[model samples]
Target: MHVDLTRDSVAMGDDVDAPHRQSLHLTDDASLGDAVSAVLARPYLAQIGGGKATWLVVVDGTVSAVVAQQWAGPRWLADARVRAPGAIHFRYLAQRDPGEVYVEYSRCQGQP
Candidate 1:
């Protein structure tokens, strides 16, 4: 299987540069769901491929699936608000609340 990661990345200046493109290879998995999940999980892709990737094109032989990102990810990974053009989507993975992933830096460990 082949997947294309298209990045409409963000910048501080808010410039609209052309989208970046990268490709991926899969061994056995052939489901549309699986391809989307792999893109969401940021697996095996180069930094430019997965991070900030706003689109995904999954090519399985003659079948091609195009997906878009509705919003930016919490992290730098290429995941958030992903949707296919004509597909019924249930939440792939329910994300945890901010509190669940928060990190506290002021822990008391005494003298090291």
Candidate 2:
């Protein structure tokens, strides 16, 4: 899995209104793990007090899935789980609002 850091917006707990942007490039298919791992590995994720990041899983020029991660705290705890090839669900923060983000597989679209 090749994970690309498309966008990173981070704001510390004290300043939720202010966020900084970070750009990262990760192109090694061998080192890339699941969506959660990839998101956690972002270089700037650990430095932020709290924020959201979006990743695009690109395979041969097409985006297979979109991953969104939001986290806070010293440990940066988050829950990211994939139920299917194109489906992922995750939750963060004290509210624990689960977010279901996925992309329909191109091959499986318009089929029975």
Candidate 3:
């Protein structure tokens, strides 16, 4: 599966003061697990001081899942909820108080 990351798309939440949205482009062949790991590995997400980051995952120009990562304490956490072609979400939590959180996802080459 191949995932593309871009800052081009924006989705506004109910709050008028909410930040602009970002999105992740996923190929039809992309797996949610792989895509989530790629986003979590971004260096910008490793910054200190807790904040929320979200990305709308789109497949073939259609929104498929919403991935979010947040940190506020000793752990950095992320999750993805798929809304197309399936219904599922995965949770990732790592201790981040004294070290970095490493994200790695592995799957069979022919599997999705």
Candidate 4:
């Protein structure tokens, strides 16, 4: 995914105020909810791709999910975002027949 470091944020702990929180733009199909659980468990991404950056999935101005995915290899440089590895969860939010995926990340960890 084309990560916009200028538009990303991060909250270390369970503090009401996030230590670092900024608006990020992710072009990949991954969402935010996909990364929440993984991030909570481990701050860093194991592989790469979607999990590389912590994201918030927003659809129509509402938080639909959290996403995190593994990173891709160098061969995937052509379109890194499309090959991200991670999980997407929108259980709390209502599912749309055909919804959009928005991933907001702190940084863009390019493919190896």
Per-model CA lDDT versus the true structure: 0.34, 0.34, 0.36, 0.29
What is the per-residue lDDT of model 2 for residues 6-107, given as tens digits with 9 covering 90 to 100? 332333452442233333344433332344354556553333234454443443344444444453311211222322122222222222221322323233
lDDT by residue for model 4 (1-112), tens? 4321111323323234322332333446653332233233443322323334433343323343344332121111122233323332121112212112231222232211
In angstroms, how far off is 14's CA in candidate 1?
8.4
The count of residue-pair clashes in candidate 2 stands at 0
Worst ten in a row by lDDT for model 3: 103-112
Look at candidate 2 and give me any clashing residue pairs.
none
Stretches of candidate 1 exceeding 4 Å from the true structure: 12-17, 43-112
lDDT of 1 by residue, 1-112 (tens): 5656554334433235334455645544454455455665763222332322222232322113222233333221222243332221211112223222222101211111
Candidate 4 differs from the real structure by a C-alpha RMSD in angstroms, to one decimal, of 13.4
Per-residue lDDT for 25-89 in model 3, tens only? 56665555556555656542332234444433344444333344553221222223332223222
- Which 10-residue window in model 4 sums to the lowest lDDT? 71-80
lDDT (Cα, 0-100) at 2 in candidate 4: 32
Q: What is the model-wide C-alpha lDDT for candidate 2?
A: 0.34
lDDT measured at residue 42 in model 1 versus the true structure, 0 to 100: 68
Listed in order, each prediction's TM-score against the native is 0.32, 0.29, 0.33, 0.20
Local lDDT at 29 for model 4: 68
Among all windows of 10 consecutive residues in model 1, the one with the lowest summed lDDT is 103-112
